[model samples]
Structures are given as structure tokens and as C-alpha cells.
Target: MDLTYSAQDDAFRGEVRDWLEDSLSGDFAGLRGRGGPGREHEAYEERLAWDRHLAASGWTCLGWPPEHGGRGLGLLQQVIFHEEYAKADAPARVNHLGEELLGPTLIAFGTQEQRDRFLPRIVAVEELWCQGYSEPGAGSDLASVSTRARLEDDTWVIDGQKVWTSLAHLSDWCFVLARTEPGSTRHAGLSYLLVPMDQDGVEVRPIEQLTGTSEFNEVFFDGARTEASLVVGEPGDGWKVAMATLGFERGVSTIGQQIGFARELDAVVELARRNGAIEDPAIQDRVTRAHMGLEVMRLNALRTLAGSGTGSQGPEASIAKLLWGSWHRGLGELAMEVAGGPSLTAQGPPYDLDPFQRLFLFSRADTLYGGSNEIQRTIISERVLGLPREQKA
Candidate 1:
């Protein structure tokens, strides 16, 4: 409940703010506001270089332990860093899957060899990683994943399709969930394997969105191979490890996402005023609700991090997802309303959209991806509220 920052916290925030303001200039100046949610395709090569720059400055994995090549920042300090980074309008990061998801999972569940092999690369931004959990049939219902992998000759051969994989085309490695035990169903008999994406058997086809951008991709793993030792936890324990990774998905970096959301809200408000849409009472009410929702989200996320401490998430994580997803989607509606008829048409050329247009289009998927709102409600009901699971037919 202590929302106030200590003097040390204030100093840390100032340090973060100063570093970002200074470093995001010169050669990195163009990256100030590039590579955000719907704009990941912007200046990607430059952003990769920016990631390495962050790694070199020891800013890649601020929440990780010191032994793992991180700043070992506390929860409050981590929040401050993310807030400052977003406030500075620093470029959206490229190595988040590796730094935020895989690094922590490796530290927590990976073997010594796995940690030694992968943790340093993650810290140094030497290799990028992607999540391979969702499949053609198992986007949110992970228990039904159809991807299968078999162990043979000290390697696991994987065969399946993973859809909507973010950055799969650019990633060096993928932490995949596949069925290892034949005839197993639901959450059982699955293995979490770290497979390389460069092999010939792997194929990545970018999935173009309504925004005419392809930040997501369809990855085909046809006999994709990885060392048997690459599995994070024991075989057939992917349910546990994968769920743990889902928990990590809602870690401290979410504060940075909220800051970004705040920026988006500001943009929408500015658009309303510019277009004179603010005169509409309904538009004004929606704008007010969006602002209030952002505050509530930040508070809820802070409370979650306080109790959960950057580790695996509790049921509260579902609430966070639901809240932010709906809020962003609503903002998209508001943006469209503010833009009026102008929002319906592309700015120019072969399917190009301005920022507000892109936001409106991309936000449509907000409620669908990363555990859909419906699935989040199910989690909240069964896990958080202790409701009985609906009987399956």
C-alpha cells in the first residue's frame, strides 16, 4: 500500500530517466518512439542494435539476480526503470522474450548446463528467443496442443505448427511445448524443449494483420531438432513449466507496458481535441473511463508484483490480462470514434495506416491473443474464485 517511493527509489528513477534521455540520442535518436506494439516492424535492425546497446549497458535484465549478469534490481526499482524507460519513449525492446521470459525460466527451472548455456546469451543479447506454446488448435486452451516431439539419438525431433508466434521469424531459438507421450491428452505428457529456429526443418511465414504489418508469424517445425538436454524441466512436465512461463509473462515489465498504454491514451485524447470530438459527451465519458482504467490497472499490477515478487503468477495475473486487454480494445474504439470517417480509410499506398488507424486495427486482437478475455475469465472463476469447473460433455 506504500505507493510513495523512497529517496533511493527516486534517485534510481532519476538515474534511469537520465540514462535513457542521454543514450536514446545520436545514432539511436530515430528509435525514440519506434518499434512499439503495432510498429515492431519499424527499424528492426536498428532495434536489434539497440538491444545489444542495452545489454552492453547492463540494462537488459534488470530484475534478474546479480549472479546471472543482471542489475538485481528490487521490485520497486524494477518498476521505476520500466516506467522511466517508457516515459522517455525509448524504443520497444526486441529481446523481451529472451530477457523477460526465457532468462527467468532458465534461472528458476533450467538445469545448471541449461543456465550456463542460455542465461549468458540472454543477458548479452547474443540470441533471441520466442514462445512456442500456442499451436493451430491450442491458442489459449494449451492442454490440447497437437505438436509432437520424439526423443532419439540424444535429440528431440519436433513436428507441428505454431501460429501467432511473436518474433518467431527473427528468433534464434524457441521454447516449444510438444506432446512426448503418445495418446496423452490435456495438460499431461507434454515436454518443454528449446529448439533452434535456424535449422532447415523450421519455417516461418509472417502473418499479416489488419494493420498491414506482420509482427506475428506461423512457424512450421518439421523435424526441428534440439538436444535432449534442452528441456527446461523434466519431460512430460511442460504443463508445469509452460504454466510457469505464462506466469512470467505478467512480470515487472508489465509496468512498462502500462506506461505505453498511458501514452496511447494521451494520443487518443489529443486526437479527440484536435478533431473537436471532445465536444461529444459520450466521447468525454469514454476518455474519462480510459484514464481511470489505466490507473486501476497500474495499481492492480503493482499490488500483484508486491505479493508475487516477480516470480510465477497467481490467479491475479488473469485479472491483469483481462483488465488491460479490454481497456486497450476500448481505447481502440475511442480512437476510431475520435477519428470518425477518416479512420476507415488507409493513409496511402498498399495498405499503410497512420498511428491511430494502426492502433484501432491492432487493438482488435488485444482481447484475443495472450490468453483471450474469455479464457482469462475462466481462470479467474475456477482458480481465483474457487468456482467449480464446468463439466465437459
Candidate 2:
């Protein structure tokens, strides 16, 4: 995989850096580092405004085609934008679920009518989305979903529960996976449906986490109705479309994620030195190993993107998932170890946690969400290595 940046690409990077600096340094300065995992409630309204500002400045969807309201940039240019954005410490985006996942899926797989109906809203951040693949019974094994939907008159009626749905409470719509055929088992007869979230039939209850935040949620769809035409692909082709969306979930932004990881690692290293934890050889060894892991994560992501197409990150994307998820969790542990005894206590009463404490707590789920480490290993073994599938009970 080539890592060289051309003169034009370097100029593009400069433009992105300058715009982010100017934007974040001015009226939006308060949002420089607000709003992320474990802290999604921090200045949320302002962060939403920051997202709109990004959309207006034409900086939100860099790699999508110009016809679809994106810059149509090359892969490396996209990488440069992400690196610069992370370096600038911009606020976490509010519509990433729409911009990164659904936008690309519609562009690649949706009908022209579907693209016309959804792409504009996604581009302008007028709507936010959440994935409904994981049901109460099916979290990592997504194909085992039991949510049911059926066509009635002119609408599709849905009924089921989706747990661990991030941003559901704030989302305007949800893309759901449901059993469209009666008594359908496992993967067959499932449909990818775009269901609106504001109807009386829908309910969203927040799930509080160890970090004392409720960014994740449980959504109940009791006869939730969406337009019959809202199905993404063919009725039974949901698995293909869903898998592609998951691929996009592990897209080029992972490079920026690693950048954030590096920053956090640097902070932990400083904490160790200040607290004298670095005087101990074991703490020193863990910190050094974290630095090395970050480098390897970056190289592996670049290699994976080299073989991937525009929207699909490919089956080997599991390897990237396994790598970063475990590495970030490990970094959290190292942070706690560096902090020594104080990491065990909260900064304030009622579960008020300092950033380091929050990191240690929230990173606990990094390996479990999106796809669990065990599930990722299974995908790598069966899909990438062509190993025989494990026998199920």
C-alpha cells in the first residue's frame, strides 16, 4: 500500500487543517474536545450545530461522489482530512451514522428514488440514523435476528426490540433488519427496512453505562410503520446490504480513530511520568507496548483499505476490528495502572468520573460493541482463512 502524498494532496491537507483551525478557534471554540463515547451529553446541542457547520463548509462527506453532495476525493485525501480533523480535536460528529454508513449504502445499493429521497437529508445532516441489526436475542450473531415485519396496505409494519442501539434516542430514523417471511429462521427471508422513529408505535429507552451516560439505548417497535417503498434492497437481500453497511462501519475513519488513540496514549504516558509510575519497569513496559500497538494498527488499516472497494471494507475488516478494539481496551487498563490508587475512586459523588476513570470504564466495552472480539475472530477464521465453520448447538 502506497503512503506517499502528492503535492495536490498536501495542498488539500493544508486547506482542511486551516479550515478546522479557523472554525474551532472562533465561535465554535467551546466544542474543541466535547462530545464522544462516555461523554455524549457534553454540550450536545452545540455539537449538533458544529456538525451542521461542517456540512455547510462541505467537509462532512469527503469521499462520496460529487453528484451526491460529497467532494469525490481520493482515498488518501480522505485519510488526510480525518487525521487533520482529529488533530484539531474537533467535536464528535452528530450524524456519522447517516454520513458514513447509510449515505454510502444508498449510493451503492439503493434505487434512484431511494437515493433521491435520502441522500440529500443525509448530506445536509437534516436527519440522523441508527442501526437496528442487534435485537434482544441477536447482538453479535446478527443473522439470528427475530424482529418481524410485514406488508400491510401501503406501509410496512414492524414489531420487535433492538438493544444497544447507539444514538437511537436522538435519531430521526432507523434502518432495521426484520423477518419478512413467516417462520423464517436465521438469515433467510429477512429485509432491510428504513423505519421512521417518531411514530407513536416506537419507543426509545436509554441504557445507562458504567461511565454514567446513556448514549446507547433500547428501541421498541410495536407496529412501527414506514413506507413500503423504504426497503433498501430486495426483500431477502437484507443480509448482503447489512454486511456492506458493517464494512463501511470500519472504513477510513479508523485511521483517525488510531490518531485519537495515540493522543490518549501520549496523555497516559505523561500521567505516568508526573505520578512517578514510569519509575516502575512494568508500567514503562506497558506504555512502550501501547505505542508499538498504535503503529501496527495504522499500518494494518492502510493495508486493508488498499484492497477494499469504495463502500465495502471486505471480510478482513474483522482483523482491523479485533486489532483496535483490543488495543484501545488495553490502553485504558494501562491508564488505570499509571494512575495507581486514585483511578479506583470517582472525582465526585454519584458516579462523577474524571476523564481517565471514564476511559478505563468505557473502554471496557470497546471489545464488545460493533462486533465482539470473539465474533470478529470467528469471521476471520471462517471468511478470511476459509476454515470449516464451527458446529452450532
Candidate 3:
């Protein structure tokens, strides 16, 4: 596949770079410090402002259809925009679930009314969203979710708990998966719904981590209610609709993240150089491995995008996710090693800050979230290698 950028793509990249350099100003380095844990309030506000700026310029939803609030750019332009945004070290808008997963799913499956109501809000950064999928008992085994949604008079009453919900405390709404039917098979009884977060009967409690911050939440829904019109697709068809959301999550969203990770890898190499670790053969080897991993991921993203039009589900997407997570964790670990003692502490002078330390702490969740590496391996084996499915009792 031709991964080369055309003249127009190059021009778009340059424009995005210039705009970000001019518009995105706040202590991004400080925001980077606030990256790990609970309620980086200032960081969140800055990111929201940035999102609004991009939305006003029609840059926030670059990949969306023009009939929606986007510029309707192609995949190449989207890639270029992300690359430039990473280079600028801009704080990414905190509405990834809305922009990446829910918006796309709505475009593909929602009624025109749903699209008109939700898509514009997402583009304008007026409504923040979180994915309400994982539960205490169900994460990688997503189809095993037990959150129940019962049809009432003109509404669906939802009751269950969703754990590991990122940014749920700050989200305005959630796109959730709930069991609409009991006793059905794991995948068949599920349904997807859009529920407002601030309503009564919904409680969000933060889960503090080892990093001494809480970026995720335990969202408890006790008789949460939404109109029947809020149901995405048909009831009992949520398994299929959920796949569309997860496919975008695992495919396109991962590509955007890999771009950011590549930049962080570069920062690691520079850190090694500054710390006088570049001369060590071992350090050099680690850096080389990180570079190779980034290249593989980039190529895989390109291949996936190229074959996207043909409706092909290649193994490269899983490979990309697996490799990116592992490589990022490695880079984070290596950064700490190169930084030596100072990296152990989370606080220090600006230039003396240990990026690796923070990254290492955060990277621990990479393999666990968004379908673990083990799960991806299973997908590759069954779907790509033509292996027999493991029989269940």
C-alpha cells in the first residue's frame, strides 16, 4: 500500500502544525504532569478550550461526514492532523469516547434524529462522553456484562455497575451496554443505550490507583432511565452494534494513540542522550527496539486504512495494538532506568521531571484496557490463523 503523503496532505499537515503552534498555548508541560490521576481540573479545562477552538474551525471532527459538523477529510488528512497535533504536544481533547467510538457508531447505525442531536454536540465539545462497557466481572469478556435494562412505559430502566470507566466523573453522558434479556446466551441479550450522567440514580465513585490518582471510576446505575428513542439500533441487536464501536476503538483509535506513543518514544531517546546513557550498548539496543516497534505500528495502521475500503479485517490491527502497548511499556521502563534515581519520584523541577516514571506507571494499564494483549492474541489466532475455536462447557 502507498503510505506516502500527497501534496494536499502535506499542505494540510503544515496548516495544522501552524494552527496548533499559534493557538494551543498553556503550560502543556504542566498539563503533562497532571496526566496521571484524579481531576486534573486545569488540564481538563485547557483541553476543552482547545477542543472548542478546533470545533469552531471544523478541525475537531476531521474524519466525520460533511453533513455532520466535520470537514469530511480523508484518512490521509486525518493521519496528518494527528501527527501534527502530537508534534505540537497539544493536550488531546478529553472526549475520545464521544469522538472516536460513539460518534462513528451513531453515523453508522443511529436514526437521523440521533445523529442530529448527538453528533453536533460532540463536535462542539458541549457534551463529554464515556464508554460504559466493563464491569467487575466482565472486561475482556465483554459479552458477559450483567447490567440490566428493562423496557418500561416509553422508557428503559437501567440498573447495574460499570467499573474502569475512564473520566466518568467528568463525562456528561455515557454510551452503555446493558442486558435487555435474561437467560439468553452471553452475546444475544445485550443492548446499547445513551444515558445522561448527571441524572438521579447514577453515582460515580473514583477508583484511586497506585499512581496516587484516580483516572477511572466505578459508575453505579440504580434505576437509571432513558427514553426508548435513546436505544442504539434495535433491542437484542446490541452485540452487533457494540462490535462496530469496539472495531473503531481497536482500529482507528489505536492508530491515533500509536502516533502519540511514537512521539513519546522519541522523547525517551532524547532523555537517554541527556542522561549520558546513549553511549551504553544496552541503552542503544532498547532505543533501537522502540524505533522498530513504532515503524511496525505505523505500517500496520497504513495497511489497515488502505484495506478499510475493501471491508477486510486483517490481523495487522491486533498486531498493532499488541506491539504498541508492549513497546510503550518498555519505553516507559527504559526511560526510568536511564533517569536512574530521580525518576522514582513524581515531583521535581520542570526540566528534571522524570517522564519515564509517569509513563511507566501509566503503561501498566495499556495491556489491560481496550481488550488486553492476550485477548488480541486469541483474536489473531482464531480469525487470522484459521485456528479452531476453543470449545466451552
lDDT against the true structure, per candidate, is 0.90, 0.90, 0.79
Show pairs that collide, candidate 2. Answer: none
Tens-place lDDT per residue, model 3, 116-169, is: 999999999899999999999999889889999999989989999999998999
Off by over 4 Å in 2: none
Question: Candidate 2 on 261-309: residue-level lDDT in tens?
Answer: 8888989999988989999999888888888989999998988887774
lDDT of 2 at 330: 94
> Which of the two, 1 or 3, has more TM-score?
1
- In lDDT terms, how accurate is model 1? 0.90
Candidate with better TM-score, 2 vs 3: 2
Model 1 earns a TM-score of: 0.98
How many clashing pairs in candidate 3?
1
Clashing residue pairs in candidate 3, if any? 38-214
Task: Point out where model 1 deviates above 4 Å.
Answer: none
